[model samples]
Target: MTADPKSSPLFSFGVPALFVWLWSTGFIGAKYGLPYAEPFTLLLIRMLLTLVLLGVLARLLKARWPGWRGAGHLAVTGLLVHGCYLGGVYYAIQGGMPSGIISLIVGLQPLVTSAVAIMVLNEKVSVRQWLGLVLGLVGVCLVLLEKFGLNDTSGGFPAWTLIWAALSLGGISLGTVYQKRRGTGADLVSGTIIQYMAAASFFAVGAFAFETREVEWALPLVLSMAWLVFGVSIGAILLLMWLIRRGAASQVASLFYLVPPVTALEAFILFDERLGLLAMAGGCLSIAGVAMVVMRPPPVNKQ
Candidate 1:
């Protein structure tokens, strides 16, 4: 008996599913992480610690470092995925937009990534993917519309929230495209460690330059910071790298569409947020669309 290549390793898809779930929970992670430390300071420390942890892990595993040539390539990844995108989103969440809203909005990353892939990566997408993109957009729109209540006073969120959300999506799409064009330089552990450190550096620099308000001290805050470090940065990233390494980029990114709904579900379950009609519908639509687009197997290699 022989293994079927058509299976494409269930773990590849499985890992991304878990990755999105954890990512959905990242809102909770950020919400908890921010109270104790400034955003920049928090991100900075998270990256630094991740780098150290990865370094030790690599050393034990006898990891190979790609050295300086790899560093430049890694820097770009850090900037888009970690620095601009994450930095913008975290600060926005800290600034006040709800995590659910942000996830719903950021869910557009796959659609954007698809467009970019067509234009830049020269990757061919099926009509199904385009349909999926539209359906996903509608779902996102439903989620956004729910944010409004009939009340007239303060009836809307800060305009900047949209800007920040867009920035986050834009960064991620650009980052994905960049990765497709330029494969990573260092090994997963090393790549992540370096990428995170770069992001952390940006945050640290920002904290020193801009943060002014006093931060509260407490156990929850300490725990939150630790969670961001070990849980989100370390845990989630490794899972992400695993998925990317094992699966096609389209297949891997499609999993991100699941993040919003799953995160919303978690928020409702754990945080007592409402599971509204819009959220439910949007979740379904987004999932369906993503599946259609991602599940379409890439053109079979010609013999």
Candidate 2:
């Protein structure tokens, strides 16, 4: 019988690569969409649209729904992974924290996830993996170093905004470990539907409570919404859940190290952003770091 292509090495590597690329575009999408809508309002619309699309998909695919207990677990994951992480990021940026600073703050996810995983999941991290995590963080710092012109302060950096960024970091790091610990074995499609429902409700509340809920609905906003809803919320998120189910939490979190570098490249291409040599070097280090964390050693031959 022919080997299942899903088990191929290419599939393993390709899926993560695709997830990184798609996730990076989220920054680009937010940049395009945020101009036309408040952050909470924009996320509210995106989550609702994602729910509608996923609902239809679940119906067509006859996806299995988790039990109520499983659904509650998924809801918690959603609140942390989608609600806190995305909401915090948007609020921080809206509150005038530079994107580079926010990225660096949130880019600490791998280290945080690894640390939490050790305690929560009792997952073992080799020294090599620890080194990789540290290197990845250093790489992210280098990539974003030029953008750290905190001296300017013309954008009015509120000290409180750092709290939002820190919330984002904590949410994603804890969320990954939580998912690895409690989110396994659920149906990806239906479980993710539950997740989106919870996240949508969170954003909806934020929109009503805080945002004006005014959306300009221009072409750029529309395109950004479409991409974020279909490409990121659906595509990349599903891949993330799949990876979490199949890999260690720390291993999966390492993939996030690539996001800032990839986002920088996307911004450079789409928004005419400058890429310094340090950023290029940092990108290389991030790639190497992730490879170390994710790559497993070959089996030794037994005599």
Candidate 3:
């Protein structure tokens, strides 16, 4: 008997939605952790723990190791995905850019990814998908408009901070496409172990160069590190790699459009941030666009 595709451990049901929610929480975890440590230092700790955990998991699972060339590619992709992306984000937040503004800037990533995928990966996007991308971006703006209001009162962000955030947008977008093109054959656990190790090295260098490498080890900081390392760097990232390998890059990137709204809702519940009706409507619009982009049409039949 043929097995159901959704039943596969990699493509299990609700994985996409689960990924978005978990990924969004990384920002929250950062907010929690950053108070007790510098950006590079905090990330160095998370990356090191993630590397050790993934390495052990890879060994126990007897996961296949990539060949030398594939290992190189995985490391490069990790530099972009984990190193550049998180480095940019953490540095920006530390530099005093409001998370709301940074998120808004990062919201441009789907459109950027779609264009890059067409050029780099030769992935053709349907007009409907393009429309969906636009609608999703608009919805993100609507949802985040109130947050921007907070930013205005928060004072001006340094130009370099914006640059770092923009680099993060580029990092994740290209990293996804890079993995789809280059890292497809590697087993998840082994590949992820290498990725985290490389990312840890990157952050360690940054910490030594820029930070005091001090951590308070407070309860919230330790808990935040654990959540980010295990919950985000492992679980959400594995799901992301699986999705990118199986889906069109454009389609996969479109899912990021939903992240801001989801993160906003998470903020509401966790931090008691206000959730307005306008934001709800915008969230609905963003979800509608995601559905349009990801839900494939039924296959045509010839008589």
TM accuracy, model 2: 0.96
Segments of candidate 1 deviating more than 4 angstroms: 4-9, 147-155, 213-215, 246-250, 297-303
* Predicted candidate 3 versus true structure: per-residue lDDT over 66-160, tens digit per residue: 89999999999999899999999999999998888888788888899889999998988888888899889888988888755753644577888
- The local lDDT score (0 to 100) that residue 107 gets in candidate 3 is 83
| Candidate 2 wrong stretches, greater than 4 Å | 1-4, 147-156
Highest lDDT against the true fold, candidate: 2
TM-score-best of 1 and 3: 3
- Candidate 3 segments whose C-alpha is farther than 4 A from its true place: 1-13, 150-155
lDDT of 2 by residue, 12-46 (tens): 89999999999988878887888899988999889
Better by lDDT, candidate 2 or 1: 2
Task: Measure candidate 1: CA RMSD.
Answer: 3.2
Error of 3 at 24 (Å): 0.6
Per-candidate clash tally: 1, 0, 0
Output the worst ten-in-a-row residue range by lDDT, candidate 1. Answer: 147-156
